[model samples]
Target: MLRSTGKHSFTKSTVIFSLVCLLGIALTVDVFWATRSSSSSSVYSSIASNWPREESHVVVLPKAANDTDSEETVDDKANRVPQRLLSATFADIPAPELEWEQMPSAPVPRLDGSAVQIKDLLYVFSGYGTLDYVHSHVDIYNFTDNTWSGRLEAPKDMANSHLGVATDGRYVYVVAGQSGPQCRTPPTSNTFVLDTETEKWERFAPLPAPRYAPATQIWKGRLHVMGGSKENRHTPGTDHWSIAVKDGKAIEKEWRNETPVPRGGPHRACVAVGDELYVIGGQEGDFMPKPGSPNYKCSRRNEVVYGDVYMLDSEMKWTVLAPMPKPNSHIECSWFLWNNSIIIMGGTTEKHPVNKRMILVGEVFRFQLDTKQWSVIGRLPYRVKTTLAAFWDGWMYFTSGQRDRGPDNPQPKKVVREMWRTKLKL
Candidate 1:
């Protein structure tokens, strides 16, 4: 109607009212679109995970023996994760290729156990079974057959847990360790060797003194043992000892005193590369059991987890290497030499910088001897300590340790028998 009378029908009040109505409609539409655009952007931001949504997990049920789903370890089409494997924090850096698969559970559950890999067989020595109850049997797993051989009885004098063990391909040499359990028990200097080829046991010259979880490795016709807790379980031992060995027999009658470690403690990862013997991780303090208490109530003292790394060179001199990314302990045997790099996985770390609360670690750390550098390469499904680790073929296998209770409660909770392996490019 205003279009036909546009020139003369316009009153001043009506024109003002029309203009006001038009402004109100425009503001309402603009506000509606602004709110709708904000809502849309929030849901679909730079990262799809920015908004809140129900998380769907790809649950991996414990695989049973004879389950054909083993191939699902890597090829599972149903695998779904809440976010990308690599974090946005990584920027454009390409992460190392890594994939982990849960293998069949170990024959038994134990920590502080000594594991040695032979040609095709894995020999697991005695260790603390349930609450300080030690198992003196050796459980052998044949990687070729994926079967566990019958339990082989260890030497009667062999320490039950915290044994310093090394393999010369066919022979596993057991060094000093705690005899029975923790706390009240004293360490044993008794040494024994098991010949995997002959299925025989032989006694060797003992260490000068006993140690708990001593850093042990075989290199250049010698077995070197260094650094561990003393008999009191709270004292740190820095002494190093070595003896000439040949074909499962001690060529020398006694262990010769060698160089001492810069920092001495137990639960450290020791690996021999060429002429260098590297010792990494371990602790500074230990729990002490009551003097005469029957229950063996241990007191957690000034426990300190450390990342110090020491290398014993061919010159028989001690040198320092790159420390761990974080303070980690209780990874004594959870390490192996892979492609000139020492790969260490899982341990306990100081959760708080001030309070020093211990928390279990689940990361795979690599120390390249050639570059003298440390890098975090991967992560495990869960955090664990004292995992018996060995590199077989191209896979890194680790099994049997105390699963993390939680950060709040750093105490040992569940000792798991689950075995896990990850493929590594050689």
Candidate 2:
């Protein structure tokens, strides 16, 4: 009878242990299933909610008609609808309200040049053409007639690329750019002045340092050139120089050195509004140490591009502005002072393979000079780099840029002859 009791007790203990183990296993499975379901549901919800909204915002170009009759019809109403849509969107945005309208192309394909609007006419000068050669011809486009005409050639030895251009009401100054052989050594120090009134080009005082890709702006009636690569193609400098223009010539006074940029690199784009100058987007290096000494081998160090924005105040103080959304290099950024806000536009992001991965942004951002806040504007018609932009009569004209291919085989080909005039609602 005692042995029977002991066996029953052992069976009872075994049953209780099995029940506990089963309960724990069930709880574990329930927790895991709950977690996985919650995670997947959240992901799907986010993706579904986000995707359509983005798609809706995209502006699709109207389809081109192939037949002559269709072409004529489309041309009559081609950009009319797009302009209306853009105008409606701008009504909601506050100061510097804007609209975009496509314009006819210049006479020839050009990029990496300088453009200035004098009176009702826009002049583009000295840029890289479809071929590798630097262009000397000046092209004039009249907004009144909606026609384009080629003008006199730039002065001999004045043909250049990557030059800094600024207009002081009468003439456009082309300063310090690359002229000789492709992808070769140092660029030229030659500076050329284009007289908009005369349709003639003349030489100016040479820069102390021969540089390319320098940031330039007209401040207080003086032209300033800052932060460009010198000697070593990859090594950019922090030097700053200024030339005061008087009677249509750059004064012979020595370049006054200003405060060096904390982080020095190439200055790809710049804009001057009022008394402030904003410089944006370039690369910084990190040198590797050479063997045996503290000296370093000149390889492309950090090789990192930036979206950093720097503003030089009227008092010549440098202040950091809000950074760009992403890293970009070799941009052609400028500020269009509309109402009280400045509109920034037309720049390239970091280099990537193909046109897809590597994006050329047409998105315009408005920077309120007083508030220091950035707001998004309408996008551009297409991708462009090293383009020239000018603001006139409440419209922004963007012209002459190279269309990027891809990274696997990047080509500096694809020159654009198209011109786009985006009217602002300010």
Candidate 3:
């Protein structure tokens, strides 16, 4: 069964209540100090008490005759001096319209596949099938022809979901992923590279350790792979490594293993901007008490959603940035680079009644590198999970995934074959 990585069982109400209590105590102390001090005492004393008090050094300024003779009008009391308005001709121009355009569907309907764009074609790799079939089929879609075609099947050894696929504009690289049909399977280190020009596949050096659902990116001339499932789906591993590449081949140098992350999780979306790589939100194990444990009342070992974001630069330095505004986890969402800003669109999370269904949202978020802030930009046309997003020229394309809504039933629907494109407002 498909499960969401976004569910959390522990309550944060206790922590919130403690913070409120602290604020209340701070307010009470401020009030006591203000009333007790002479310099800060209340100024609203009765007129009778102030009148003719010989011991007090009080001087009242006389009010203007116009002010005392008539009460101020409501407009006069509320008005402020007007400031000069700045004018610009651009304000007359209408805002750009954003809409989705349907494109040619894939040859076969699949979910959780890896989509990579090279020039005018989009190559989709192996994915999980609607009826529990794991695929090795490779499909290619050409934008110029508005048609779909079949490519050679991915190598038998490298066929699976959770695979890390990336391209260097010439060659495509496939990395580790789960090798079975089950949600929780033994992750493999089988790796390969396909020559886009020759239409042939060749084996490449495997990962240092097994990983599934890892985030992969080709920055500069190297392939950087980080964070994923190891022994089991819940067991997130922290290992990160990069393989040096030159002239469409893995360099002879050994794969460099970097410092491990503080915490690791599966299906985290990562993207590369210039020399830096960003590891965005994903799922991690909640280290709470078990059901039968001593502190079991507060414990639910559910999967925890994360807004934890970390960045790694060229010098091999890692820095944690301001997190996403909300928890982002579970579904394999796409992270895109457009006009120097990062855009994350469409992913899923689980809502509770404990075993009912998944909650999917089409929300969009943008991360600004200069200010280290994230803002909600907009949303997708529909709710999607495990969808793929690509950018070409000025248009953004999103394709092929399950459109889950409300509750999941025994007989699930087929995977979507629709592809949607939009001209992004940069």
Q: How do the predictions measure up, each by TM-score?
A: 0.74, 0.67, 0.69
* lDDT per residue as tens, model 2, 155-213: 67763666777777788878787664244345677887777777767878888888776
Clashing pairs in 3: none
lDDT (tens digit, per residue) of candidate 1 on 1-426: 668677556676688899999999999999998897677666555456564442322222333334344455542333323233321110111235468888888788987787888777778888878765778889887777566765789888888888899989888899988777656567798999888877888888888987888989998899999989998888898998889998889888788989789998888888888888888988876877887877566666777778899888888888887788778888878887778788888888754332344567777888987899988787776678888787777788888988776643454578877888888764
Score residue 182 of candidate 2 by CA lDDT.
43
lDDT accuracy of residue 334 in candidate 2: 42
Q: How well is each residue in 265-302 modelled by candidate 3, as lDDT tens digits?
A: 77677777777878888877522323454422223346
What's model 3's lDDT at 88?
A: 18
Query: Whose TM-score is higher: candidate 2's or candidate 3's?
Result: 3
Backbone clash numbers for all candidates listed: 0, 5, 0
Ranking of candidates on TM-score, top first:
1, 3, 2
Candidate 3, number of clashes: 0
Residue pairs with backbone overlap in model 2? 97-425, 286-302, 353-407, 354-406, 354-407
State in Å the error of residue 361, model 2. 1.8
What candidate 2 gets wrong by more than 4 Å, as runs, is: 1-101, 284-303, 333-335, 353-358, 404-413
Q: Which sequence of candidate numbers ranks them by lDDT, best first?
A: 1, 3, 2
